[model samples]
Target: MVDASQFEKLTTVAKADGVQQLVVGAVVQHEGKVLLLQRPDDDFMGGIFELPSGKVDPGESLDDALRREVKEESFLDISAIREYIGSFDYESGSGKKSRQFNFSVDVRAAEPIELTEHDAYLWAPLHDDLPVTDAVKDVLQKYRELRAVRRD
Candidate 1:
């Protein structure tokens, strides 16, 4: 479980770093695979694979935003946010300077996926070279590294 006790610290760090928008991303894995979503062809960053992610609502804590975004985008409820892998900076669809905080999470179930914001979803195996943006791929790489260490 993630504690909102880190909320002030995260926001302060973001503010200090001049991040205009804060987004939360989840690396949701079940079995030996992590979940990936394909963006709509007409949407921003279209036709690319990405982790379930979204902007954090004002006043929403990081954990809350991550879980909500995963649920809303992938229809999967996060049971636990296991680790905070790291973050990456990028420009948003509206050109806002954005930073996405990434985490490794576990869903209650990996089935019954209903993608509302994307066209497709997949349970990408960790052993494969994933087809995602450089930033997302880095996050997933870090997640895999962390998970491997934990399991050791």
Candidate 2:
């Protein structure tokens, strides 16, 4: 559980800098496949494949925000939000300059997730062929690196 005081401190810092966007995503893996979500043609990064994620609410801890976003977007209860994979900056098609924090998470389960903020979802094989945005790719590269080390 996150501390209430820490949340307040984070909220203060976010407000101080006028940070408008801080998003989090899960690099959810099961059976060697990673989860991917697609934005609708009308939305930012439309037609691009990416991990399930969303904006962090004020006073929200990063891990808590990650679990909430994954649950809301993918309908999966996150069992754990693991190591910090990395972060990347990007400008969505809508011109929203945002930063995305990525992590490897374990999911309790997943179904055909309801698409409210996304157009589609898939459990993609973590291979070179999987279509994904550069931001997601950066996160995946880290996942791949960690995976290799574990195999050693």
Candidate 3:
């Protein structure tokens, strides 16, 4: 668990040193399919397909932020969120000048995605033809790997 002091220190360093810190994102799955959203026209990777995620707010746990972001963006309430699936660092096209940590989470179902937030949404089949961001591809690979192991 990341403590407040640790996060504060990280933030201080980010501002002072202009160094980017960790951000949290979610590769949320519902039913047998995973969720992906189109980045907004003004958003980084805008028009590109990507996982539903956002920056982790200060004093917020990764899981909490994941749930909150998913709910806010997708307009869906998720339960039984699993632990970290994987993380990748990237500079957001949003010009945040920071790195982001994307996590894979499992959910029973999403109520309904709020389309105003995104151009489109999809519940893509596992290992099937679907549009997704590179980051999402990494997370789904892990999801597929886990599922394959379970199948065996």
Best by lDDT: 1
What lDDT would each prediction earn against the true structure? 0.88, 0.77, 0.67
**Colliding residue pairs in candidate 2:** none
RMSD of each: 1.1, 3.4, 4.2
Better of 2 and 3 by lDDT: 2
What are the per-residue Cα lDDT tens digits for candidate 1 across 10-105? Answer: 778997999999999998888899899999999998999999999999888888889899999988888888778889999999999999998888
Q: Identify the runs in model 2 with alpha carbons over 4 angstroms from their true place.
A: 1-19, 92-96
Q: For residues 20-111, could you state the per-residue lDDT of candidate 3 as single tens digits?
A: 54566666776778777887777666787777777777677656676788887887766655545655656655555665555556565575
Given candidate 3, what's the lDDT at residue 89?
59
Q: How far out, in Å, is residue 5 in model 2?
A: 12
Candidate with top TM-score is 1
- Model 3 CA deviation exceeding 4 Å by range: 1-21, 94-97
TM-score of each: 0.95, 0.82, 0.75
Q: Residues 22-102, candidate 2, lDDT per residue (tens digit)?
A: 777789898898988888897755888889888898767777898899888878888876666777766654566666777
Cα deviation of 48, candidate 2, in Å: 1.1
TM-score of 2: 0.82
Off by over 4 Å in 1: none
lDDT of 2: 0.77
Backbone clashes, candidate 3: 1
